[model samples]
Target: MSDSASVDIAGLAPAVKAALLEVLIHGELPRAEIARRLNLSRASLTRITRTLVDAGLLAEGGTRLMAQTGRPSEMLILQPQARHVLGIKLTGDVLYATVTDLSATAVASRELRLPSPDPADVVAEIAGVAREFSAEYPDIVAVGIAIAGRVRQDRAGAVVEVSAFLDWTDVPLGAMVTEATGLPCSVENDVRALTVTEHWFGAGTGLDDMALITVGVGIGCGLVVNGRLVEGAHARAGQLSHLIVDDAGPYCDLGHRGCATSMLVNSAIVGAYRVAGVDYEGVVAAARAGDAVARAIFADAGRALGVLVASVANLTDPQKIVLTGDGIAVVELAGDAMRAEIARRLDTEAVDVDIDVRLWDFSEWARAGAGLAIRDMLS
Candidate 1:
């Protein structure tokens, strides 16, 4: 339609635009550099930036330029404190929350034990956490909440199906959180929100396509393609957890046998450990001790994971594959076999793909949540 609309920041209403500018207000950049980075013309960037400056979302500064540069160019910086947002991560056992400024830096954080896993109670607790954070950061504009269980759009962002994991079905969670926190709120699938964070600023930042596999209590994969996180029409795209590696390995919660998760997930390994009469923690210690049986269990999971990684690399053709999660504690024992299996499963030259195995701590997850809030502001 018009020039500003053509800037490619879709879904960015004026409020969102002001929020985005506020995120950049602390860091000054030249007009031409900003245009180049954001893929907008200098004229358009200048106009919108001036508008943001006038709105107090950004500040303009200048200095003398070299003779070839004619004069020192004025610079634009984001006034990050102009606004802020809150992020909440709810899981089966823990409630991790953060208050972040427009730049996505953590201002405050809280990790409290969950009172109960009940959906309403959990949502209420989440809402309470948001309220608490908002009271501390009075300028907070919106909130981004992430849930570990399945969250989907029943009718487009209405959070119709929160899935059977936490028994959250057709719950008006977004509305509830908004009403409780007095801020616009949006709930996200935890892994997908984490993926969005990674795709934009972490390991996958510049790659047009990549994937993150979280191997923990559940096997999760998040895929990005063509510079956008893949959100399938059904919002169930990267369910690589149930890729059916064995077709008969073990019964999975998905009612499938030998799924990737069933055969290779942490619980699955615990099952394997039990078969050998060892506890899960004992198994990790034994693997560290190079116990053959413990090592084999880790190897089995790694091999299964390797095949799945090969599948993702082949199917998505992503340039990078990042492996992270709580499962990585034993990954060292399984990594070699997994690598071998990945090589074996590749049909072609494997695209010369690079794989990064990482261990995600609470801070990274919190940062991902903050990044989600930042992304919400940008959009």
Candidate 2:
């Protein structure tokens, strides 16, 4: 185990830990700024920061000149490389992994295609990856695994209540991985894990309220409210992909007609073309070439997504909404229609909210797992 893995963070006072985290999140800040942001008096801030500096968790960096006086104040900065963590995203047939520093910056990554989704098989594969990363970066303290499912976790450990894609249920995923790799493991819902990454280090940074909507083989959402990821009672909070957008649209596997899953997912779009006797590639090519039929199909999907986005905005009133996933290309193709529908559906209060569109790959999700590891270590 690394020194960080054995460090006694519990020895620090809670207020001191909070102060250290504030600096970790916002980067180097003057002592006065830290005190103000943390709502602490100068004496309190000094005590907390000094303890963190003594613990080697924080470093006093370059001084900043005060505007009111000619005096300078030293800035408190977090030591990003103080510890490293591993994050793994387990899909149906692939495990994407990344090694990140305390700041959640990926310094190394790898992918392994699973031969099967059996619990033991996946566990062995995860152990292999952990060993590889451990050999290269002995500083890695713990591992985070993100799976697409209903994850249940408590003081005992984490279990996958259900993994719809992998057809898993009631599996002790955290225990399995930990035993296999000889390291602590944290398992989380993939979307929720991804949300944690965003809340801590990605686009959702500095915003207390934001939503991430992913479009792909399945529609997924992650929500952060009041500066915390909302993992509901059963840890299945943001399941909006099945929200019905059109009553007459295609039926989802869950049996919802015209739900976001039925209209916006890649499988749904490709299935629509198959039903219409058109090749999938031909449909995308035609859509790009302005074919009326292909364009209409994408436009309809976009409109459904627009309704979904607007509904989320009205309900949560988040500061920002991120649109991303493997199927986001469809949204870009039909951007005009989607924007129009969003404008029409949004309440006056939500009309001006920022909706950022980003294209993402599996590596980002892996990084989310790493972010969760960091959070687990700190917490």
- Each model's lDDT comes to 0.72, 0.84
List the pairs of residues colliding in candidate 1.
24-78, 25-77, 25-78, 25-79, 26-78, 64-72, 65-71, 65-72
**Candidate 1 ranges with C-alpha deviation above 4 Å:** 1-29, 36-43, 54-82, 117-120, 154-157, 247-255, 275-279, 363-366
Task: Give lDDT tens digits, candidate 2, residues 129-235.
Answer: 88888787877778999988888885667999999878999999899888888778999988888888887888887899999988877888898889888878866
Global lDDT of model 2: 0.84
lDDT of 1 by residue, 1-379 (tens): 2232223332456643743443353256666556555677657776777667655566776753635567566666766666667777766678788877666677888898888877678767877776677676666677787776666653334473664456567777777766776666667777888888777656776578899988877778889999788879878878888887765587887788878877777777888777656666677888899888789878878888888889998898998998888777656778788888889888776576588887767655666666776676576
In the predicted model 2, the residue pairs found to clash are none
RMSD, model 1, all Cα superposed?
Answer: 5.4
